[model samples]
Target: MSTDTLDLDDGTADRALLDARGLTLLVFTSQGCPNCRQAREALPDMNLNVDRIAWVDAGRSGGLVARYEVFHLPAMFVIRDGVYYGAVQASLAHWDISRQVALALDGYPAELP
Candidate 1:
């Protein structure tokens, strides 16, 4: 229950899990944001493991949001190997998210289906 740790559904002991994990997608969302709502809805069809992603509420996690320098809503960052890999904003499509994540993690182009 660290101050910087977020409340996760997985019951993970660590709150700073993203900074220590392999490939993690940190999605910054805000209430009443249309783009954020769209991103949430698209999550199910994105063809990615839910466990690798964390949907963070920007309002609730002000410090965490500021840590990432996320000034916009519906922003996502790919963190891997304890490094900030890359980021994408206002993504509404599954392919866009998947491609950005792949490019950040794999260092190559991702083909969409």
Candidate 2:
């Protein structure tokens, strides 16, 4: 399925996640991070099952960084129907990301941060 990508901040990110009807990949990134830039370029073309990819600028989203416990640049989380599925632990490769997302969804949902 086609996925939409949004560049969101703290408040907007929170609203977008809460309003999302399908699976949403919430990614935390920073401006100077090379991995983050690669993610921005690669995510749209990746064959992921998510309906939307919500990007939160870690430099600007202190609240979200703190909430999600983001210590790295390109930290990802899976959210389905407004419930948190947990962090997505995968490489930047499309296949790895898709596989990890599927595996993450198989587990029980976590409390939204």
The number of the candidate with the highest lDDT is: 2
**By how many angstroms RMSD does model 1 differ from the true structure?**
8.3
Give the Cα-based TM-score of candidate 1 against the true structure. 0.68
Give the alpha-carbon lDDT of every model: 0.60, 0.90
Give each model a TM-score. 0.68, 0.95
Q: Give per-residue CA lDDT, model 1, range 1-113, as digits (tens).
A: 11122333223312455345555566778888998888767764566642466678777776666666787888887666445666754357767776767767665323210
Query: Per-residue alpha-carbon lDDT of model 2 for 1-113, expressed as tens digits?
Result: 89988888877877778888999999998889999999988988886889999989899989999999998989999999989998988999988999889999999997789
The deviation in Å at residue 94 for candidate 2 is: 1.4
Taking every candidate in turn, the Cα RMSD to the unseen true structure, in Å, is 8.3, 0.9
Off by over 4 Å in 2: none
